[model samples]
Target: MMKNECSVVQDVLPLYLENMVSEGTTVFVKEHLENCSDCAAEFERLKSGRQIDEAAPQREHDTDVITAVKKKIAKKIFKIVAVVCLVFAVLFCAVLFYTGISYPVTKESISLSTKTDSEYTYIILETKAGKSLFFESKTEDILNDHNEVCGRRIVLYNVQYHNSFTKNTSSMSWGKPLNDEKPYLEVIVELENDTLQISNAE
Candidate 1:
């Protein structure tokens, strides 16, 4: 083969080394390498015995490619997780802020009134403004003082002006009114200097 032809055969040496060429191409390259001294030396250099085994270099190359792909996949997963966590954190803070601003427990946020039916007392809360705040499940027993253990108790916290519910003062327990066909019970809901005093407006 001419010197130029020898160069072309050298270019295909890697595929021949991996046994990846057709039988005819392999025979042609083999004949050129046998006659070409420079190509023979280059092939011998590629076969230098530094591998752990006869085929370890191929395995090592595949391992390197797999490792690179794994690193890229892990980086993408980390970015996705970070973005999702950031979005959830922002949403949580927004809901907390809205609840703190919209549902503040202030003297004006609550009002006490006797329903026209006179059989029930209403704990009017701004949270239930213009909505039916009563449920059949919330029977008179919910307001019965005699059924204290089974009945409901309202635990209120002393909140500072412009403060969040999370920063409210220690809680205090109060027994709810017993609506026993009479609204004569004295209703007192004291919060520091602000007391909510309501009576049966006779």
Candidate 2:
């Protein structure tokens, strides 16, 4: 009879710890544990194990929540960095499109003329009508056989943007006087693979 009671108490111990056993079963198990040393020791061990079992899931849940939060934060940071890089790339391309020189000056794109005055002879460069273009001019001295500076060499570059935001003008002109002592014999417009030289003949 005592052996049977011990077995029943042990079986109901887990349910009792979880408060699932009825009050009558609870009283029976408690009275058996109070009297039997072996049953009391077994009940204490089961209670300690149940406490640890209950805490393990809470710890696991907390770790899972932390891991999920970290993953979400990482995803948000990646999106922000991606957007910033895209904006920087677009701005960099826009700067290149607006400021970079695109084409070389050509005869069909401009008209060249010379204006003579009492003191100086002016070389005139003008863009053709309805052209949305600008010019960059670089001047170098023409060298003779002895490396002497004989005249000036003017090279013009035509600049135009690829976008429609660029404003069109009827004409734009650049005029500079030829030096009296060493007159420029050539006004060169640099093409893609060749050059067009304007005759300075009066």
Candidate 3:
């Protein structure tokens, strides 16, 4: 009925190529193509290489999109780990430094031995840890005080030879010094290599 049959052909051309036309439109185009060989030939040529039945193949490569996302995630994880480790290390070192600084200086054991007689006398003072001990001394009636005896050395005792106590003296004397606060322990003895003994008098 339409004089310009090509108008129907053109209208159905797009829908026919896309395979989206209804069955009625397809049948109508078939009838029109039976009379018009030009559009039919054109349609066959247009559809020769192209297939509407098949969809496009999936993409081939990701182009580093996934890799970039992974890299960003890995970087964030590494930064978090680094921050945590750094904080722990700093806290641990701070605790250790604080403990070291606040710690007290340990005192060592002190051992002193003294031997006295009517003659020459000697004393050996030792520490358990090879460290120094708090000690001070005085002679005769020099003032013996804690603050005064810190770094000063005093004569232990005086020994007189060829004088009183002409006997072998091997005696230990434990007495409190009237001047010093600490109790005094004195040992009086004479080695028998030459001649020695003890004197228990008054």
Give the candidate number with the greatest TM-score: 2
Candidate 3 Cα outliers beyond 4 Å, as residue runs = 1-11, 17-20, 28-79, 95-99, 102-202
Q: Is candidate 2 or candidate 3 better by lDDT?
A: 2
- Report the C-alpha lDDT of model 1 over 67-132, residue by residue, as the tens digit: 999999999999999999999999999877755452334566455554334344444323223221
Please give the CA lDDT of all the candidate structures: 0.57, 0.72, 0.49
Candidate 1 residue 186 C-alpha distance from true site, Å: 2.2
RMSD of 3: 19.7
TM-score of each: 0.39, 0.45, 0.26
Per residue, candidate 3 scores C-alpha lDDT tens digits across 1-202 of 4547778776777688888999988888878878887877878876764653342231213546677889999999999999999999999887666434421112222234555455434344433332222222354332246544321223422222221122333322333333444333332222222212222111
Model 2, runs deviating above 4 Å: 1-8, 20-25, 101-202
Better of 2 and 3 by TM-score: 2
**Model 2 quality (TM-score):** 0.45
Give the number of colliding residue pairs in candidate 1. Answer: 0
Clashing pairs in 3: 168-196, 168-197, 168-198, 169-197, 169-198, 170-197, 170-198
Q: Residue 45 of model 3: what lDDT?
A: 72
lDDT, model 1, position 93: 91
Tens digit of lDDT per residue, candidate 2, span 72-152? 999999999999999999999987776563554455766667776765666666664434455578978888899989777
